[model samples]
Target: MRDPLTVSGPEGPSFWAEHAWLGTHVEPGVVLDTGADGRITAVRTGVAAPPPGAVPLRGLTVPGLANAHSHAFHRALRGTVQTGAGTFWTWREVMYRVAARLTPDTYHALARAAYAEMALAGITAVGEFHYLHHGPDGTPYADPNAMGEALIEAARDAGIRITLLDTVYLHGGLTADGHQPLEGPQIRFGDGSADAWYERWTRLRERADGDRVTVGAAVHSVRAFAERDGYAAFAERTDGVPVHVHLSEQPAENEACLAVHGVTPAALLDRHGFWKPTTTAVHATHLTDDDIRILGASGAGVCMCPTTERDLADGIGPAAALQRAGSPLSLGSDSHAVIDLLEEARAMELDERLRTRTRGHWTAAALLRAASEDGHTALGRPGAGSLEPGAPADFTTVALDTVRTAGPVPGLAAEAVVFAATAADVRDVVVCGRTVVGGGVHRTVPDPAGELARAIAAVTT
Candidate 1:
């Protein structure tokens, strides 16, 4: 499954869209010109017809979707974990079993298939919240950063951009006593101490290129590290990079944090000066008012994984409230429960409607913004999610002629895309001026489903 998608040529490529959402509304007969560097040079609306030598995209085109959170290896557990009544804790036990079976080689295979699935779903960029470090028994491989590097390679092979959020997982669990020693499968995720994690991360970041893949730092969560200095040190080490952390996803996490620190997890992070402008709080599901205020005031973005949250019964997050308080909201397909950013976007609004028993909490355009521009911003791809001049030439077109989308007129095409379309509705995907998926099939990864089945078998059995 080597990459066959070509980047822009010396002449780049021209594409004409039947309709396109240019930031706010859908416009008809849109034309886009990409430069040699894979940046959009111009956008013309009302062209009515495709120019000569231009590829015609017959659908509602939107900016490339950004998957702000992902655990690629977890794709192996998709159908297997759906049985019986299980909590997140129980589901994690099964997940740990799969994690213990990974080698860097198998990981690359699995991640390649997982990322290719994301490509078919129209994801042009992904924020891999990676923590699978070291060997199975807590020993570093010949190359300590080998697992991290496999993810970078997998994204490249899938023809998508990735931000490797190299996470620090130093503790096994947080008990009332304090942080516990790394044990069992958890050991594979830890690096002895935060300083040691910093050393490995420093090396990875220095070697990581800024183009297709970049390195970012993560604290894992307050449960994994009670000490504040490690986070501070990591912040300094990854000064300009984005910092992401799992916030209060479950009520138990909030309880534990409050029991130990006398504050919410968000407040605890605030106390450590970890709330930088580029910081993103993943799954800020259970937050106090003060927690919301702190995140909003500190300019930290919130990434909501509604599909995964609902799947794991993690409860809905305060997305509209967070936005009202001044925090930007982004969507992520965390846990790979489903990689449809369109579903995630609508779930953000639909879940809110379920919670508040009201409607119109978020406009379709705002939800798309979260899945695109804001998500890219969270992943450190600033301004890469727009179709305007100077932005990266990355976009996906959804087929409005599909059974799920045929009723809507072109004027409300954006609404059809946001409210009706699924991943299957995406007919074409252009990333960095390259066609990764055309006509609902991956251009490079032949047999993504078969690849996924084989990769999962290698690990699970």
Candidate 2:
């Protein structure tokens, strides 16, 4: 095996993969050339062998996976929250307890390790749906954006691209009576009002690098935002940025929205013109036909976190219907129940099969698109998640000879990967022409598991 750690010169780097997935199909003996600026300069296919000095990626190489939605701190709650019987609402309480323990230093430590684990899973970029602002008692730090900045820095150290979705979370929960005030750990997430939230978001935007780090915005959910007009104002002000919101993840949320706003969460957001091509709805698990039509017609995308949905008993989403209605689908590892995007990808199809009592609801290629290109687009990184020229030089090589991925023919390798392979099968990961993980080992953070253990212990214990 060639040393993946070797750096290429001023002209840039070239990688030759045994088999490469070119969006729709797999091609053998493909060479991808990257420019000095870290964009794919050329893709030369049908080459029988690696040219001199070309890095040899001996496996099925695919575009770097994009985790379209994540709550980085939630990684800490993985095993701790699984012990007892609970629903999504109950899960939220456990999650909030973990949230309350986070300081800026500990947040950065945990997120860095979490993102490094993502890198090991072939993820090159992540959409951090961050809302943990202020101190334990809702006090702003010296720099109000300190926690947000910590996450961005953590992603940088983890050698992955990050879109910090600076979230505006006001109120605690919605009820039949009205929006409730923040209580307990929930107080840490609010920024007083929409104006105050946007002010902090504006300052955070100034830190965006526009390449590896894109600053975006999100409303935690309709239940968390009582000021209805704030959604419209946020939409208008942050028009071009990637906007995300937690849609109807639970039936109770829909019931509350209907009682308070006389519409489902989807309809309520649509009334404020929140749906758009750039906006992505995370965990849109429950939707009426009208909700589907509204989201699809607006060309907004949906991100499904199947593992988290299943772990929390959130019902299977209408992924196929939403897709047919013209909404592009994306996948995420929300709550970090599992960090495998392939698992998230396959679970979406497998869950849909269980729901409709049918197979082939989605092709493996289509599922990979959700994990890759469409996901990157939802995170404000358009023109990524492909091996075509002018795209970012980001890709991961999955070991075909691994125990899980061994038997598939070259043509069906993509199917083998999406259906059978896990994060452990990822052998190498490259982002922006830089090697972050090689030979199944992360380069920057040498021991991700150890880091994760230490970091989680700090906040949890």
Candidate 3:
């Protein structure tokens, strides 16, 4: 591969070559030559230069990574949740307290900072499982979708693509036989019923073909919507759109689901036809063999929030076995426990090692696929996860010479990316040919860190 020049014209093959040893990943045999639209227009192995008049971009490239699951506002709880006697349940209590407090303005401010952090961490897109709907009184806003719009604009301000998984969270539990009722902040997240919420969900704004956002759906959980048709009804209205759910993150959730529905959360969700290519199950920490099989056969993907799971003592999902079982894997920083894709990917395997006491299970190649390709699938944008031609030019370039990836060739970049690197190692981030993270900073917004602090202050104090 020769050094390529930068393109200035309206059109030309945007030539980018990998002089570093490449990480043969995802479709290991496939190659790509991408246009400005981020679609690969050509395919072949071996490095090829642009056909003249093309602009060259320097740095090692991988497909842009997708954060398949995120609760952007929760990024604020990173340090706040680790206090005394903390567990997922206690964390949930604090989360409700915060949720009970956010105004649409506060959400936009905090979420803008959160999405900016995601972009800086090499996340090209995020599936924001937004459930902080309505106001403190639980009444519909004058605009109905005002809160949703704030989040969308925040993503735009951050310059990262988003699949807003506008969540429908009805009920406090599976039923009176299940958990409790609307307590603290949980009231703000609920919308009455599956059909009523679906009507409001359809009222969401959508992005254009070249737009950087898509409106998706999420059931707070099977525990939140135990009725058989809860998710199915929502999916029907979505018409094959991406749907996400929080499945069995804790044993208590699994126990409750079984006690009420006589089935695992996964089985209950499957019986209703809510598991599919367009579906994403967040956490999915506690699953039965039957649960695993159902997720695999449905062609659904599990988003492993390794850092958050570890932080909250949430059990690990069967990431490797699930993939082998035919379900794809993806990564997320749910709760922003760490908010680093590299750490998220590495923890996927480390947790497996802890469980099976095994040496090797998930490889760099597979984790990259999950972080990039599988994540894009759940984001309602295909091919945005890789660097192949005609694929979305979404990618993040790390400092090869940095301590995180020291002594690494481009081939090992993927491995180094998984095990050692941090968001700090990412030197440049490209999303749809627009630079989001450059020189260790976000271009569109000044003082992102400060903005985040201010936003959090506004919400907390």
Candidate 4:
């Protein structure tokens, strides 16, 4: 039979150790004791072994990774959206039509499968940029938080942590000029006023049992929050929580913002107190110098979705510039075009090389930190993404002995990880000291492809 502990079937934590590494490299005596609340009570990093009875986890210990941004609904559209012509705009027309028909049942099935895949790939947490809010035709449900509950329950079933970045999407575009109305499924998301959306934002429940989920907030964009009241109200409400927004994701958004407010979306967010360390700017392609300055000055985080960016033909983001300006960088599997974390990291650096006149613009260490540490920090989980004392025993172990990464010392394993590792080599994944992935597989009931098929049948047929 398989190892009893292999599938991580809700069994409690025990003792763990091995070649553990955090922001830096691995050290022995790295025994981690996980608490009932999922906090780290003690970390002894000497040659000491667990006293008395013990459980030994003999692999590299590192912080669990956070997918800083995701749109779970889009996971269904992955290969289907690949062959589409036209630009992001044309694809979005098709997306909106699909979004118009989803019920909570469909979202739960789809998200559970997507989150399980994230676990298989060693992503312990995700900040879901969710905005599809109402019934099939943009009408409010009997319970306003029904859609939110579906997402939360999905995370629980997948055995992963989530920060549901509940969103506020108001208008379709600038002053209703050439901008289309909240057409198709857009009506389900709006609350009539930004203040009204703020009221719902405040209703978010911030705690999760077993330390697995949390609620957060997001502003869809400058286009979604056209009114001065809408943006200001949102920022003020989400002051201390994890906040995210789609800022400067597209040049058209910038042009529209300039046409209406005479500023880029980043500048407009700054004016509205939306820029903060707790904030994550998604995509963040097409930045001006001032845009970089504001992002750096605010100390917000950036999530570069290389797969989605390349898939949609969005311009490359200024990752190196954002780093130089003091913004902590992170990665996302936005639109679920690809859920592999290392690919996101590698594509980020490679895209920089493709766009600029320089080579070696970003270090492998930086990419690794962005993948594991920065994202956890940005996710507001203390001591996350590290193997030090007081950090959650959340981690993934990869075999460096593979042919793809045999060229470098294990000291450079993190770099090799970004450059050479694929999801296939991720041998184990742990969340809160609970083994979730073993035999290089995550145990989940719903089939991912089947779930995608169901979603397609619901929306397209």
Off by over 4 Å in 2: 1-9
Clashes of each: 0, 0, 20, 2
Which ranges of candidate 1 are over 4 A from the true structure? 1-8
lDDT of 2 by residue, 296-340 (tens): 999999999999999999999999999999999999998999999
lDDT of 3 by residue, 233-307 (tens): 666776567888898898988888778878888998787777888888888888888888899898888888988
Regions more than 4 Å wrong, model 4: 1-18, 28-30, 42-59, 175-180, 206-210, 444-458
State TM-scores per candidate. 0.98, 0.97, 0.90, 0.90
Arrange candidates by lDDT, descending.
2, 1, 4, 3
Count of backbone collisions in candidate 1: 0
lDDT score, residue 284, model 1?
A: 97
- Whole-model lDDT per candidate: 0.89, 0.92, 0.75, 0.76
Tens digit per residue, CA lDDT, model 4, 1-461: 23211224333365555556656565654666666545556776775666555455554545677898899888777777777477998889778877876788888878878888888788888888989888866677787878888888777677678888888888776642534467667888787777777666666563443246667788887778765555676677777778888888888888888887778888888887778899989888999999999999999999888899888988899999999998999999998888988889888889999889667977777777888888876666645777655676677776566777556765676677778987666767777766777656666534656765776577667
Candidate with better lDDT, 1 vs 2 = 2
Clashes of 2: 0
Candidate 2 RMSD computed on C-alpha atoms after optimal superposition onto the true structure: 2.5
